[model samples]
Target: MHFLQQVINGIAQGCIYGLIAIGFVLIYKATETVSFVQGELMMLGAFLGLVLITVLGIPYWLAVPATLLAMMAFGFLVERVAISPILGEPAFSIVMLTLGIGYVARGAVMMIPELGTELQVLPVPYRDQSVAIGGLIIGMERLVVPAVTAALCLMLYLMFRFTRIGVAMQAASQSQSAAYYMGIPVRRLNGLVWGMAAGVAAIAGLLLAPIVMIDSNMGFIGLKAFPAAVVGGMASLPGAVVGGVTIGVIESLAGYLLPEGFKDVAAYVVVLIMLMVRPNGLFGGEVRKKV
Candidate 1:
């Protein structure tokens, strides 16, 4: 029973990591650039929800849509104002820029009065509720996380598989020059991809806030999600989900069965082993570069 409980907990946390990993994969596919600020973007999303619910006294249902829209707009502005100018720069520069953005975001959150210093609780009705099945008990909030993650993954899959924009994004990812020649509006697509990624991050944040305290440093969990992305294959969306669950389960088992702090290091150790054995990730395809 205890083991089952730990597995459930791990799955819940893994779902958040999976969602964040989706953002990482999306941006990488669109621009071949990793947005180191994705975790901070998640933090910002949670803060947005906090402001809406706590400060404005908005209902949770209403706050969700409002937060998502705000995140979309924020993502659009970020791409246009910060990322677009450096589009042609070296990859390392873009990475550093994202890191700077993350730091600035975290710093700005800390500058907020009262909210920055103290941990804030998001009062969701189902936060502490749970369900029991036989000898296993599952928290509703924890169950919701993985369910939502799966639904989001399905929605994303459908968007990319059947939608025109999805096809355009796919084309652009494969070859930007060809996509542009085909009238795909690659640049605009890139911006949209960023917006989409940010929106996803927002969803991740909102879901996570109920499970953990909302704070400036909450985004650091993205570090774990990064490993999830790598283990699943950075280029594969489904792989992200798989990687997240695997990492989550591993971490959960480790935390319960092993010494303290084992769970924290489990994901990274798995990632390191995976990288040494399969550099492209479990589901990632091999890319050959012509010299």
Candidate 2:
């Protein structure tokens, strides 16, 4: 029973990692850039929800959509004003820029008068609820994360598989020049992709806030998500979720069964092993660069 409980806990935590990793994969797919700021974006989302619910006293349902929309707009603005201008720059520069953005965001959050220093709990009605099944107990908050993630994944799959805009985005991801030449509005699509990624990050933050206290440093959880993206394959969306759950389960089991700190190091150790054996990731495609 204890083992089952741990597994359930792991799965719920994994769902959070997977959700953030999906943002990583989405941006990478659209622009081939790894946005290290995803974690910060998530932190911002949670803060947004906090402000809406706590400060404004907005209802939970209304706050949810408002937070998501605000995040979507913020993402679009960041891409258009900050990221898009440097699209042709070296990849490392773009990476550094995003890192800087994250630091600035964290600093700004810290500058907030009342909210920065203290940890606050989100007022999610489902926070303390749980369900029991044959010696196994699951928190409703935990169950909600995975359910929402699965539904989001399904919606994303359908968007990519059947929608015209999705097809255009796919084409742009494959080859931007070709996509532009084919009249796909590649630049606009890039902004949209960033927006979409941010929106996903917001969802992750909202879901996570109820589980963990909302705070400026909450973005650090993105560290775990980085390994999830790598383990699953940075280029594969489904792989992100798979890798997240795997890492989550491993970490959970290690935390329960092994000595202290093993869970924290497990993600990096797995990444190191995976890189040694398969550099392209579990689901990554092999690419041959012509010299």
Candidate 3:
């Protein structure tokens, strides 16, 4: 029963990591660029939700959608102003610029008069709610996270499977020149992709805020989730979620079963093992050598 409890807790936490990794996968698929600011985006989203709910007194339901839209627009703006000009530049340069942007965002958040370096609670309705079933108990937010993530994944899958815009994004990611020549607005779609990814990150933030609360350093969780992205395969969306859950389960089991401090580094250890064993990742498409 205790082990089952850990698994449930891990799944809930893993859902958060998986959601962030999905953002990573989305952007990478669209632009072939890795944005390290994803964690900060999640943090920023949580802050936005907190302000909406607590500061502005908005209802939690409305605040969530509002935060998601705002974050999406912010992401679109970021791609246009900061990343668009250097579209063809080296990946390293773009990565550095994103890192700078993330730091600037964090600093800006800290500068807000009502929000400083202090940890703040997001006044979510489910803050203290819990559910028990068959001798296992967990918070409502924990259960909600997985359900929301699963829904979002299904929605995205459907979008890609049936939507024209989705097909165009796929085409663009595969070969930008070909997509452009096919009359697809590659630039515009890429911006939208970033926006969508940011929107996804915002959902993650909203779901996670009640569980972990909001803090300046919370964005650093992105580092742990990064391994989830890599372990699942940077280019595969489903892989990201699977990798995240795997890491989460491992961490939970380690924390309970292993010596002190193993929990903190367990995710990275799994990532290392995955890299050594299956660099392509589970569910990732096979790499082909060019003639």
- Would you estimate the TM-scores of all the predictions? 0.97, 0.97, 0.97
TM-score result, candidate 3: 0.97
Clashes of 2: 0
Worst 10-residue lDDT window for candidate 2 reads 282-291
- Candidate 1 on 206-240: residue-level lDDT in tens? 99998889999999988888899999899999988
> lDDT for model 2, on a 0 to 1 scale?
0.92
Write the residue-wise lDDT of candidate 2 on 1-291 in tens digits.
898889988998998899899989999989999899889999999999999999999999999999999999999999999999999899999999999999999999999998987898899989789998996778899899999999999999999999999989988998888897898899999999999989999999999998889899999999899999999889999999999998898899999999999988988888899899998888888884344
Q: Rate the local accuracy (lDDT) of all candidates.
A: 0.91, 0.92, 0.89
How big is the positional error of residue 103 in model 2, measured in Å on the Cα after superposition? 0.8
Enumerate clash totals for all models, in the order shown.
0, 0, 0
